[model samples]
Target chain A: MHADPIGVLTGAHFIDGDHACSEGAIAAGCRFVAGYPITPSTEVVERIAERFPFVGGVFIQMEDEIASSIAIQGAVWGGKKAMTVTSGPGFSLMMEHIGLAAMTETPCVFVDVQRAGPSTGLPTMPAQGDMMQARWGSHGDYQIIAIVPNSPQECFDLTVHAFNLSERYRVPVMMMMDECVGHMIERVVIPSADKIEVHNRKVYDGPKESYRAFETGRDLIPSMVKAGDGYRIHVTGLTHDEKGYPDMSVSAQGKLVQRLMDKIRIHADDIVMYKEEDVEGADVVVVSFGITSRTAIPAIEQARAKGLKVGHLRLVVVWPFPEKRIRELAGKVKSIVVPELNMGQIVYEVERCAAGKCNVVSVPHAGGTVHQPKDILAAIEKSLRGT
Target chain B: MPRNEIKIGGFGGQGVILSGYILGRAASIYDSKYATMIQAFGPEARGSACSAQLIISDEPISYPYIVAPNVMVLMSQEAYSKFTPELAPGGILLTEEDLVVTHNLRADVRHFSIPATRIAEELGKRLVLNIVMLGFATALTNLVGRDAARNAVKVSVPKGTEELNFAAFEKGYEYGLQLLKKEPEKILA
Candidate 1:
């Protein structure tokens, strides 16, 4: 469906990534937002607060990140697209609710403008440290979708995709923006409302008395109904049966938990997205994402200049790991080099995917700033020497 | 240009970030080029030495941060002292005459000065001083077009102050042109 006209800022604008992300959320029909202000991520909610009044939306600065995270799920259940924005420290505080959202199968988006570290380290700098956290932060066995945006334009474009994916699978989609992309300003062209595609939650239209909130037919996803829609529905974090009531049987646990896992695991191919360039007949492939992807370009060009067959792979969707593509490249290429702002997070995933078919070299950094192109070039050079 | 990294520095509330925004908007939105601006975000940005880094290129900018700025626009003494050591050799330096005191001038870099604050005061709003410096930059750097810079200034400034800002811009632009024409050797040296 087309976006709402009032929320679409259709023009060429010189804006920062934070503001672009807010526009993206609004364009995707996100009318309710609850967030606690945090550095590098504050501008996102600030812009939402300023623009919500004009776009028939609501922005609430909750008391804390835990409240802010769950409030978005509540808004989602109320028939409104909603999101929350935060950074490293605040993202840590919202982990329990993220698991709650996963267990309850709530549709919402969590934007984490990642900064350096384990505990509030380098609050104003860039880091890809939250990559593993986005996928595994929430406790227990479930799957989630996360997209990393490299530019302000992608910040707008990918955010809408995050909302669409969340609504499609009734999962919490993480918009993983780093401090670099979050603060950098560039020209972002927001298209007209009709040109943008938005996904709305699937609402049930069956008999109210016989409504089953957890029943799945041919499709793995179940249709949803709002709280006041004259339907007898119950949602919870417990392992429940198809009838929406708590079930203690091992079979019930298996059915509910397996569906939650299969909904994303079975649809992994559709969820995995990446950008590949010059991979054919290449001896080495450089895998990177977010700010590191942009920083790796000059180094790739420099490698090409030195008569090396180097290819580039940039991850748009960091979760689901693009294992198929990585395995294919590993079979063809002699080695794969993964560079990131963190010491080593996603690189482990690439290594696992490579699986001894080719050598996997990780170029790691501790995370105050982005990687230097020369460092990536050096890694590429080293990988070639081994082969 | 292959790429030009420009650093605009001053204390907060002097519109240091706004000037970078205008320059980036002019290059990207109006001039059909790519520009990326990254502002310093820390405690210093509140009331102390704040700066904005911009990279302008004919192609899409990949490396967003500035390594060594080839163009430095300084509006405060603190910003000048903190940032001048990193200016690229044979670069362009534009400074406000009243606000910044020129010292330890580099031989390879070209220097140009304009009393942007005085011009903005003459135009009846000191807040438009950044616009004045922006106009001077449009003339000195030749990185952005005149019409593009003018349009960006109009679009970026607050409503009801377009007239005053334009006058301030024109004063700086004319002053830059006259200085270049009158003392090409001294400034170029």
Candidate 2:
């Protein structure tokens, strides 16, 4: 499962987050990219367009975001690992197709370089406002995985991981980035192709006549077959049976929908990823993700300087929200402080998981700029005072 | 160094961002330190106010944006007027002599001026003025080593233009060294 040598760029580069993410996608065996230019995220596709030609990849700039989003799914069905890059406005337009990708179990990646929003608000500024939307934007009860990267290095590393997760679970993966992380420049060292692991979707190997597209083994994830692979298969967005035929029966609806949800839920422990520091016997733990994670570090350090025992929990994977870990930490610590670029999105999830066992403090900001360390330090001190 | 915050400001086409990028590349790549650069983005396309903020530290940087810059490189009158007030007390200020006329300057801050545009013109390309400024900053500020800065300029600029840029850089660096020798008290620690 090692990466292809032609796609990997093995060197140390001083690149921005968007460009690093593009390199990561290329290293992960992605051969198809469809996107519409948008602020903060356009650099990802721009780099792809420049690099794809040499690696036998395709980069298509569609007319609109709606077309760009669904076009990646079509590319996936043609046996190419694919993805699309976008920002807030385009992310909103792609919600329906995200739902469609989930319903059809199309393995793809959606890179949302978020900006301040609620209808074209501060297009060049940073925000984590799309966090809730990425989880619940698509209607229905299916599950998708979302990952947050804090630095240009992680933008290169985690993007490859995002693709692997999508192919393994047969669900769409969201690469949730913000304007700050998207534009910040730093040194990113891409390893050699032999050191990187890439995962491809399992292909159906059974007899063609007995092939059922939706039939599953013990893992609840079915094997896939491409369109031109000399196999007769049908894929639909409606409630379908194991034969991939549209079924209106109540049993079929429950069976199909339940499997989709259970596939991710059952493997939530394996999909969840995070980083923690000094949480063992600490009074307050600061929970943060994306750009806010780096911004919160100075606050954590200042709190520690003042003779306060403060811990930090940075979310590398924002979705499938580390429920078990939060529940465990809530029982041990006196309080938890959550800070984000958006005004109180992930804090509610913290509150829900804490379940009143300890006080939860939310440090909210309406996005354009990142939070000052003093504000987060104040919130951390306040959370401890309430207890 | 614990940490050094730098701000470079000029018009959009003056290569303000690229200067910051070269400095950052020298520190992080050649000197083996941590550096982060963030640029200001807005509706202004070209020939308007633009800035790039950078931080270089021995330890990992937590916050990405610069608070109060310890060093400021201003290439235009507008940039000089806008960014000088935010300079840290006793900070280093480098400006283009012909472009920015400093008046009512702060007594506590150490200031240095060079005709970077004039030097580039003498070398036959005004586009390499930013490279000249980078050389002067390397000599006067002592934030980055001269050899590291030279290597960065070699790799960062477009192919086939290294000779002219290097000549421009050495001219500015020699000018800075002569200025320091004339006034030894202005030498930075």
Candidate 3:
């Protein structure tokens, strides 16, 4: 983690973007993958389709996005951690089932290697257009995890993390990748087998007949009863009680929803991840995510060369928001500029954290391209002058 | 310290990528300085002008691009047109005289036109033209050691293929050393 293997790992060969993400999933112990081919994301499935047979995993190309999403659910229920991969239009079709996974509290991973669209804008170009949708695409009130990575290497490493987080928290984890990072090829070190950490769903070791489906633990996430154990365990998408029976009562639904949200929200500090650089004596800070953040590195150097004390706060893990750190940043810097490939998505989060302690500006650009370094530098220069 | 950004451009078969990678490996594995090589892969990487950005620094590299380079190494005519304009003001341009068949008279840039492709044929391997030009680039910037660049070249290639490439690289080095000792003054300085 300290080295960012893409920058330091000289061992891996220079391969295409698709192969790297596939290797990462294999390393994460993915036993099942269901997908239908899409442009940039197709390579992910192709590489996995080739590798799965050798690794003893199931790589199924379901009829379409609907079946693709369901196959992973069936595999997960069959007691294997699973995943499905897709792009924008495919993702829209899967939202119904995304909501289903939420309701069932089924653990699986969904990889959306995003291309531009409300309805297929650019099939081959890159866009961060899906950021907001990832947080809200699946219908209804449910707590889930979505993490974004800005490079092919993070695409691999974070997919592994996404799987681990899903198993630990018992929820569907969404991996958000834009076309830029999806296509970019950097070095990806296949870590040694002993170096990899894999987490499986917690199984109830008690007597088979005694197991109850919705029984709570300290974290409020229930332990699972492996199906063949002869446990008459009930699972459902409907609002359920501790014994897994439908609860039509308003009070019971309230308690159930609160606990589900609390399981992740209360322990967010443990889940949030971000990186801050050169902030010791800075008056201006640039906050960015995904592809735009890669460009910010150059802007930071340019700003530093001009003798302006500017720093960077980059998001490696987007969800659960990393609120505490941003609030701390709000107190120190005179202003913060959050640049994204969107109009004002993540900037809103930064503004909320600032809370009038300092100025927050969204230096935004959207659609198929990234913000060039000079534009970001211009914003930093403007922020430094208080204009 | 301010780093040097060098952009190498040519059509796909010209070994533009190999040239950039050798420089990156030199700065990284051999010299132990921070370096990065980010290339754009396009349909034209084979026929049209292909390009790659090389950054070598005493500190960690920030920009993955070479927006304006301290050096421009042009292997083809299209490459010369596409990238030569972004040469850092008063920077040096090392190019193949024939590949850049048409010459530009830009007084601001110090141009050293070498017959690199013709020299490669004379040396018996047309593929080694990039290795030859890199000899000139390393000699100019000295950002990464010449020996480091040579070693990076040797290791990158396949077994048994290394011997001829080494000879090709030596021809390039001999040609480059002539530029150093024979020229009136070091333009990079």
Candidate 4:
């Protein structure tokens, strides 16, 4: 489906990632936004509030992050594409509602422009510390889709992808942006409405009397009906049956929870996205994401210049971890170096997927600024020496 | 040039970030090259010393942060003191004549000063000091085209204030050109 013309700012312009993300959400047909302003992520909502009026979108500055999280889910049930924006501390506050959204299968977007944090550690600095949290923050067995954007252009492009994945899978999609990517200014080319693709949720079109809220086809994703529709729908955090009623039986829990997990697992191949460069024959490979991946480029080039066999693997879709590709690359390369803003988050996933076939090194940084290209280059050199 | 790293530094109230933004926009958007601007984002960014780092390249920018800026523009004493040592050897240093007092000279460095704040005040708005600085910086260094910088200023400033900002920019640019004409062989590489 094409984007609505009103929301599409079709031009080449200089803008920051936060503003680009707001434009992305609008072009994806997101008409409802509930958010509380926070550092690094505030510009996304501020732009939304300023532009929403012109496009017939609703922007609500909620009381807190918790309200903002749940408010988007409520808007989803009311037949509106919705999203919320926050940073690390605010993301922590919204965890419970994120879990609620997962159990209820409400499609929504959560944009976390990550800052340094255990708790408000550095409100202004960039960090990839929230990578694992985005996947495992909510309790129980559930899966989510998360995309990390490196540039303002990606911030505009990937946000539309986040909404599309949210709608297609009936799950919350996280746009995990770091502070640098959120604040850095660059040229962003937004295409016209006809060129942009948008996805709407699959809604039930059957008779209201015969509607079963959670009934699924082979795809595992159930068609949804708006709250005001004639169909009777009940959604709760408790494990529910296909009819959408709370069921206490173990069998009901197994079926519902397993379907939630399997929906993503079964479709994992199609959902995983990444960019690979020169991995065809390499002694060392650098696996990085977000702003760190962009930072790794110079290091990779320097390693190659020094007569070391080096390649780069950039994760655009950070969640669902891209285990299959990592495993395949592990066998081909001598070692894989993972550099992240956090001490070490996704490196563990790489280690597990590599399964000791190749050496996996962690280039950990405690979150303030990005890693020095020299440091990453040093790691690549060390890995090549070990090989 | 293959790639050039530029740093703009000043106190918070000064348009340090906006200056960097305009330079980057001029190079990337108007000049049809690649430019990336990373603003200083720490506690000190608000009222204390704030800065913006920009990289303009013939190819797409890979690393976003500036290691050693080949060009440093200072608008305050604190920004000068804090950022001068970080400039690359044999680099160009541009300063606001009224605000910053130069010290601890480097022999290989080329330095230029302009009264950008006074020019902006003469143009009737102190906020356009950054625009004046941008003009001076653009004229002194061939990092961006003069026409590109002027176009960037036109789009960057608020709607009705474009003419004033453009005039402020021209004042600084003319001053810089006059300096170049007076000293023929010194810093015009």
Local accuracy of candidate 1 as per-residue lDDT tens digits, A1-387: 999898999999999999999999999999999999998899999999999999999999999999999999899888999999999999999999898888888999999999998898999999989999999997888888999999999999999999999999889999999999999999999999999999877789988778889887656888999888878878887888887788889999888888988998888888889998999999999999999999999999999999999999999999878988998899999999999999999989998889999989999999989999999999999987757
**Regions of candidate 1 where Cα sits further than 4 Å from its true position:** B45-47, B183-189
Which 10-residue span in candidate 2 chain A carries the lowest summed lDDT? A378-387
Tens digits of per-residue lDDT, candidate 2, A157-271, equal 9999999999999999999999999999999999999999999999997899999998998899989999899888888888889989999999998998999999999999999
Share of reference contacts kept by candidate 1: 0.87
Give the DockQ (C-alpha) for candidate 2: 0.86
lDDT of 3 by residue, A221-299 (tens): 8887656667786777788888778899998789888887887897788778777888778888898877777889888
TM-score of each: 0.98, 0.99, 0.83, 0.97
In candidate 2, stretches whose alpha carbon ends up further than 4 angstroms from where it belongs are: none
Tens-digit per-residue lDDT, B1-189, candidate 4: 777999999999788988899999999889999999988877765569999999998899988889889999999999998999998988999999999999887988888999998888888899999988998998888889999999999898889998998898889899989988887565642
**CA shift of A237, model 1, Å:** 0.3
Residue A4 Cα positional deviation in candidate 2, in Å, after optimal superposition? 0.6
Compute the interface RMSD for each candidate structure: 0.5, 0.6, 3.7, 0.9
Q: Give the least accurate 10-residue stretch of model 1 chain A, judged by summed lDDT.
A: A210-219
RMSD of each: 1.5, 0.9, 4.4, 1.5
For model 3, state the Cα shift of residue A56 in Å: 3.9
lDDT of 4 by residue, A119-192 (tens): 99999999999999999998998989999999999999999999999999999999999899999999999999
